[model samples]
Target: MKVKLTIKLLISMIIVYYITMTVYVVLNLVIYNSNITFGEKVFSVSFNISKFMEPYIEDLEKGNDFSLDDNNINKLTQNNIWIQVLDKENKEVYEVNKPENIPNSYLTAELIEFIQDPWGSSAPTTISTNNIAKGNENYTLLIGFPIDKIFRFKMTLTDESFKYHISIIIFSLILMTIVAYIFSRNLVKPMVSVVEDIDDLKNGIYINKKNKQGIFKEVSKNINNLSLILKENELQRKEADKAKEEWIANISHDLKTPLSSIKGYAELLKGDQYEINIEEAKRYGTAILDNSNYIQELVNDLSLVYKLKNKVLPIKFKEENLINLLQESIIDLLNNSKYSNKEINFNYYDDNIILDCDKKYLKRAINNFIINSLEHNSKDTIVIVSVLKKENNINIIIEDNGYGIKEEDFKNIFTRYYRGVNTSSAYNGSGLGMAIAKEVIDCHDGVINIESEVGLGTKIIIVLKN
Candidate 1:
């Protein structure tokens, strides 16, 4: 990017430089070859003073009157110029459109001084003098131009000096061009890098090239940070997509199993060839109902998780006794005959610790944690639930001395559809329990933290505002 931009800039500067040199050469030609100044070209005068007075100078040399025609007089007046003719005696022989301050007679010394320093005089006019002679009688013709219209400067230069000055000017211009090019290149270098980096980002390529020294240092740092964040997000999205695929497969299998059972039992009940008794029919009906309920529970979990994730789940916040809410969740779990043999303990000193929360979702989250402990461990494994008030916050801790979570699983514990590696085949689940619980806690503006070591135990802490 830098190379391309530098080349383009160098080309542009060269083009501009050459064009300027061309204009300079053309203007020099125009200035030296004509009496008309550059600014006067568009509105050129009919004739210049030197050309107009040339014919009359011959007449004055032959001893004729240095007089002008009406047309010449009008031309001189319009161009703001005056002419004076002086004869041998230093007396002004003829004058046209001359200023009042100009004396009709002059001493030779005065005439020489005025001619030498015309601009230094009070009149401050630019004067041009020409001498004409006939039969040893000499005459001078003087032309005076407005000071504002003409400027005169006298310069003395030899060939060598002129060449040396021209060489110096050319060298300085070259040096200036080189310096300007270098400065502009440096200025645009960082910008080129930035634009290229942005293009790479647009193509989903994230690179962290740190520019530590330059005006763009901060800009480079910010872009690199953004790249890192985007890279991380991209990785997360891929992981989520993989997990989603796994979840769909698992859900399909789970649904198929219950559906197959329900279908089988219904078929058995409907078979006329098999002479089924009322007791047998009742058993078949109960089996079918159980499978149906299981399917419905799975569906409900799926729906609830989607709502929670989308932040569309309505939460009815109200003050409730924390102790009672936890006890009720424990009792509900204990009421399940499958987990009745599980050893669970609830410990709390405060019975009236009040909290503002969505009772339904909060209770569901708590039940999920408790059930997770019960289902994942041996029946003899001890589980403890405790609630404590810390300053203005409430902490509910669930601990268990069970086969703790593996490190790999622990990292993604709350990720949707991520069942633990040690998940039991006997106890099937939708794999949305932990994810749902997390979402529920988040909706209540709460935090959940977990600490677990393999084979020792797992401790889960839920903190909520009081």
Candidate 2:
């Protein structure tokens, strides 16, 4: 039979107590059988009995008119005490019971030798005193107490006291047993419940918040925390799985679309036997080049996505004057022919802001934002770039007065491969630009957010710690 821990502990304690109590009782039995008790050792029997008969002993000692009364003699004999007196001739002068264990006459020297080795000759069952001399040496007194008789009397008194002592011991045992049971139950129950909860978790059964409290509350909290972490991981796993499938589908369609165009235009250019118009051939050549560049962009965006996500791409960080970095980025963007027809503006404070950032990655992110504005908006739109110190933070604000984004597409704007509903094909762009830009800013510990409304304008703001 499988025994529970509580039962086992309770049984073990009971057995221990039983063994202890048995040892106690057996030790007491051994002591009583040996005709010894703590009381006898502490106060000799003669002292006790002499106190009860003190007046009589004192009178005898003074040689006064003292003789054992019949009643007193009877009391002494009943209590196993025998008294005797002898003269110088060694003949008994007075005696009680005249115990047969000793001779009626004794030489003083012989009595002295006997006293030294009294128990040697399987001595009298009684404890005896050697001769005690009278002042004139005319008489000697002797007394004896029987060993068995003394133990009998001692047992009677002990039986009387055992009533209270035994009661207390028994009560203590019962109380201790109850306490042991309760302590064992309290200790084991919570652990058992926690183990059960852990088993449930192992079986994929979720434990509710309500289950996360007990005597072992810290263990419960850790288990609950494990559940929370697992739940989060499960959610992230599902998201990554969905994103993977979508990415594959999008990449396949996007790759084939440009490749099919390039192939068709190249075939058209290859068939020049019909004397194709020069302008028409040049147009086909342009189409092929555009498709090829778009394909290359797709490949590059995909590569950046994985590299940034894993943080394997190295970032070189350095302290830079924020104003100087912004001016440099603006100059590089102005040199681009794509934004030649677009209006650009810069506004900043005269006070320089110091920041730690990866200049290359930061410039790449800002370039994406500017390119997005130019490609997604109408020509001649005014794009404003501003830098301002907000408290302890630096704000790099990019605002474009251009055709704003549709509200529904805002949530997916930064998602990889998410091309908005109105994205243009003029730049042969991949939908990964904003996603890559967001990753770059995030890696730099910066914040980038966009605000826009349909037909109004779009604002892109980047906040950096100073």
Candidate 3:
């Protein structure tokens, strides 16, 4: 990965460098070929002046008095150039197209000043100087151009200085390349690790939580959080699957027991070898009916739970007296011979606590809670059901002094098909009672909370909007 990233970065840098150098070279070519009369190109013209005046110098050496031909003179005039030749006495020996302010003679110091600041003269001009030698005689030639026509910029460099600057440039580029590599490595390393982490997540491997640094810190944190969520979801899925298996097994057993009884009773009645009395036959028939009723109840509970979970159950809401509903539910439970021995009490301050609810389902939900308390405890255990009005809401409280729910079962108390650890083996319930109760309360936009201890018993509070 590092090698590939390094190669990619190097390629990118090379591309950038190539483009920059290409632009620089193209710009230089354009400037060199253009007809601009300033900068270094114009400075090159000053060097060419020596060659332009070479023929005149030869003529002067041959005693031609520095005379110019028509072609050469035309060239000088078209370029706006003036020429002056001076002898050892600093007197002008030959001149052409000289300006009106030009002096015929010059002092050495004045000539030096003019050379230093060519534009400082009254009739300013850019000047170029050349020396001419003919045997023992010597002369100075001055070529002058119009002021501002040529820009004079002087730069000097020795071999050592040039090499030093080149070395510095090379070193700077190397250092920058190293820095870029390090920076990219820092960025890419984390990116690669994150990719690997995602791949692991895809394979169902969760990452351990840890602190991360650099720009990818947030990304790492989010990935870790996702892993934790996914891990938790996986655990929940497993638990649900295990619960489903157990529920199916329990249902099979519960159904088989009643079905076997039903089959045995019907077979016994149909057997011709057995002389059954009318009372015995009636008892057998009743037993079969009871088992069938139990199976029907289990199937109905399962169906209702499914409807509630899928939000397919329709509820018809109407105004009902909450206290009267509780009283009726308690009375109905007491009427049942099974729960007639259970010591249950009902208490309420208000006789008319009104609420919007589905009467049948709401009563079923309340009865499930009361029955749960009765079935899970001793017959003598005191079960108290109370209704209270608090402001604009109604609270129904069910308290029981019985074998309370275990701590481990609290989390899954309202979960469908989740039987508690302390549930009796003889109590062959569908395990949807509490879950249905909670769902029904939720359907009414109410909240139900349970508090329980190992021995002190359990308290369930149902709060509803008035």
Q: Which candidate is the best by TM-score?
A: 3
Residue-level lDDT tens digits of model 2 in 154-198: 144477588878899889988999999998787778777788878
Better candidate by TM-score, 1 or 3: 3
TM-score of each: 0.68, 0.56, 0.70
TM-score of predicted model 3? 0.70
- In candidate 1, clashing pairs total 0
- For model 2, state the Cα shift of residue 118 in Å: 26
In candidate 1, how many Å is residue 351 off? 1.9
Q: How many pairs of residues collide in each model?
A: 0, 0, 0
Candidate 1: misplaced stretches above 4 Å?
A: 1-4, 10-176, 184-190, 210-212
Tens-digit lDDT string for candidate 1 (1-466) = 6877887887778888889999998976775556664356322433354665676565556544455667667767887888898888889878889999998989999888787788767687888889877566677888887767765678888999899999999999889789768976997788888888888788999888866468888888888898899989999999999998998998899888989999998888878889999999898888888889889988899999879878799899999998999999998888887777777899999899999998998999999998888778776788899998999789999999999998878888899987776654377788889999999999888999899998998999999987
* lDDT for 241 (candidate 2): 70
lDDT of 3 by residue, 1-466 (tens): 6568766876687678779999999877775565445554334423455555687666666653567777767767777888888888888988889988989889988886776688777767878888877668799988788766664656688999999999999999889788777876777788778888888899999877674788889988999999999999999999888888899998999999999999999999999999999999999999999999999999899999999999998999999988788888999999987778778898888787788899999999999998888777766789999888888888899999988987668888887888775653377888899999999999999999899997889999999987
Clashes of 3: 0
